[model samples]
Target: MGRGTGPSMGLMNDLGSKACEAWLSEHGEGLPWGQVVAHPCPNGWELRHVADAGRDAAGLQALPPGALREWADTADDGLFRPLKSAPTLRRGWRCLVSSHDDLELALGGVYPGGLGDWWAVRTGQGGPTSFREFMGRQTGVYRGVRGLADEAARAVVRACCHAGSCIKDRRWAVEGMVDGEPGGHGSIPCLEPCALVLEAARTMARMASAERTSVALSGEDLAVLRAALERASALRPPPGTREAELSAPDNPRRMKLLLEWLGPEWARPAASPQE
Candidate 1:
């Protein structure tokens, strides 16, 4: 039941072990799985198939002694493929470039590094031109500015929309109260986003309690606690605030008080929830 342990933990460990094995097979020399190399497909055919075909054709021809016999035998079916012959280097490079282009298109023009980086590492040469470099070269373009501006605008819009929904739901809960009783148990429906915010607040309190017991509270920890309290205070319903009327005893006020004691910024509000 603990975080990151037991059967679930064992599964994670198994996955990590498999991943390491796969990586070593691909990059490690002298290994059966490592003998095979794949490049992008030439003529825009699928790379995996092309690589397999290339491996098969190369094995059929005169190859040097001590070549990967097992790889060549199973080359047509299994994951392993023989390295492309030295004569096919140019064709392989073309395939690599084409494959890289396809990946860039799929990712919406966001190329992480690029063909040049791959080529440099594979060929053991100077660093290749990277996606970061491409961005650097186009800094004066309107598209660059527009991309950043649009992202920022969207983030602001989402935050404001979330806050508005929270306020609206709180108002509805207050209006739906029976007999004007602050602590009345009414079946008030809440918006999904508002419910999420409440759930998140609850989760944070639980985490704080765990941290308080397990770890020595340092100055940095106090600072974090204070900041969290200030944030809760900012969202707290004003004294007699509509939200306070709907909230249970274990509500935002508890978070606010814990935060206030950590910092001056968390002072309790002057008015009561039903004032």
Candidate 2:
């Protein structure tokens, strides 16, 4: 049977136990998304859970850069971003400044953006400072950066990272396999990709801080985008090759990608037994 595109709400018990479904919906936040404990209802909704998603160790793969936004879609829907109240970036966040283990950055500073949201950094005590203020003080690039309340900003950041961008060593860094690495299924992270992702995220945040929508692409949508990036990468200009001939051949959107203005994300690995 077919299922609803997203969370199935306001339905009755004939399809499944009202109380149980309600329990999962209410209590399943923040828990790693668990499996469907019960059989799916005729309505085609599976009773998914959230707990120890990391249990799938071999299943773990570094989240792709551009893909971060998609992952957050799972959070806002109340599936993974289990918040005390509604999921909002304005809740509370703490930044552990190494020395300040108990630094509570703000009353609200974290967003369980979703599957790929960086839970590690959000784990402990933060300070009363705004996330942007904290970030701005630390670096020149973030000097003018502000506002993490925008869902779209978060998405743009995630997608850029999935494409292979991240801030590492306290600076925007890109991780990827230029061509490919040993275990590198595709692009590895590096500095350029990180810069690209940050630029995109900032632009998106500035343009639409108020926009809100669940944007994790459907499996099919991700697959298509991935393929498109890969195909474009093939025509990228080789190093030191200054001639236009060194540039990507005439192709749609190929130039931007080949230029590494966008990075490629690593693919997810198969599930292994949890440690």
Candidate 3:
């Protein structure tokens, strides 16, 4: 089916419910989903950040399931989280939910359509949207992204979708891009380009079109820049750093893409899983 008209909301919700049921049946209710851990209790299900899963429930702040949306909307430092699946989910809170539907609702707030996308792929009713397919549908400012060179497109995909930035497995690919390893426990599949990706592409396209300036730098200068970007990539930015602010030269993804353009010698090692 054409991705634009893949499935109705009702059908997707039903499939997502089935996906939740099957997942629980297979992995048990205690298994973690992304950064959240869901445990079936006599009362219903108790949800907490994986970091707090082993902590005493009394030690963590208790929050209503409805509050999860706001909680997940921002990181622990109050920065907007553009990607819900990003590893930066805040900890130190627990939620109580009463029914399977409520549990799904709670999780939906945290991951947004994650369960539906999982089931859609598993059932073969949906699949990844290629970069070409995704950009072809773009309009307005994003229309310029369609003109991005293949090399720039791949770099954007790698920088924006790297596991270091988001945990969702990137099922989508563009020309010259290689497949990424499947994500581990608690990870979900990303079936298409997100808004952030589209915006990043637009930015890169504009950057590629801008007037070029040349500056001479010593070998040591290049080395220092690479080292700095490496350190930046290896650590989370300080609280309040805007992750979605792509125009910032210091944005981690933009730094990574810059490293990509500098060739393999300047490339930083892959970010550690704990980063």
Candidate 4:
């Protein structure tokens, strides 16, 4: 939208900028925040509650100056999750989505952690509604950046579309494809939406290589494909993200086998955690 940040949003940006400046002053400018922090922006910054309306301007004006980090720097190019949680929603400091894109478009987090499993939901008739359907009606920033690049990415988005319809809407077939498949866990049949998305991506990359050239992804073509798929990957909320979290296999057996893939501050398991 506009490049304006309302009174509240303006204040958050001020604090986030200040926090970044403070961090860089200590941390140095050689490295980037995305490389340093896994869950960057709106999460791992310093913030003090500013209750006084009078003191805010001074805070904004007094911000330490330098070539500060931008939202794109921390943006995983829509890798894990694109939506950032608003700090006002939580009692913490949040980073700016970008100076160019209105601060109003940075709705990244659904709920902060320390509250328990951020993905828990009610079962039975009162189960969670379709996240995309729910979010479509809202004015959150997540709605601002939706959609993917190619048919495969579209497949991932469609499969990950949060419609509990998969639970019942069996348009695919009577096969177990609707149900989640195994990754490492010996779950039921069918492809897990997350695994399906990843697999679809790999398949697409392979096809892209074969169709375009026998060489690997490079230059602008690689960049474009990566952005599209990553954005698609980021669009799915935490509930959908659960599908990807599993470590099962990516075999699309016994099911239709057509590939497909955040919420809260969903914590990811380490690459190699101690057993």
Best by TM-score, which number? Answer: 3
Number of the top lDDT candidate = 3
What candidate 4 gets wrong by more than 4 Å, as runs, is 1-151, 165-200, 203-242, 245-247, 250-275
Encode model 4's per-residue lDDT on 1-275: one tens digit a residue: 11122223444555444333343343332222211211223322222222221233334322111212223222222323221221111112323223312121221122112111111211121223332333234343333312323443444434433232121111122122234421212101122223233443444344334444365654556446444544544333333233333222222210111324211112323357579
- lDDT, candidate 3, equals 0.74
Residue-level lDDT tens digits of model 3 in 1-275: 11112222453466555665665654346666778887766665678998897898889989888788888998777778988988888898999866456656777889998877877888898899888888988887688987888888887776777667777877777877655532332457788889888888888888788898987887668677789887786665555557877777767766666666565665344456474
lDDT of 4 at 35: 18
- Give candidate 3 misplaced runs (Cα > 4 Å): 1-16, 180-186, 233-241, 267-275
> Which is superior by lDDT, 2 or 4?
2
User: lDDT per model, in order?
Assistant: 0.29, 0.30, 0.74, 0.28
Q: Give a tens-digit lDDT track for model 2, residues 71-112.
A: 433332233322111212111111111111101111012212
Worst 10 residues of 2 by lDDT: 98-107
At residue 150, give the lDDT of candidate 1.
24
Predicted candidate 1 versus true structure: per-residue lDDT over 1-275, tens digit per residue: 11122212333344333332332234222221111233323322222222343454443332222222332322222322112111111111111212222322211111112223333343455433322232234333222422222222222223222322221211122112234322112111122123232333333333334445455676557567666655765553434333322234334444543442243443334345574
Model 1 scores worst on lDDT over the 10 consecutive residues at 85-94
| lDDT score, candidate 3, position 133 | 88
* Pairs that collide, model 1: 240-272, 240-273, 240-274
Candidate 4 local Cα displacement, residue 128, angstroms:
26
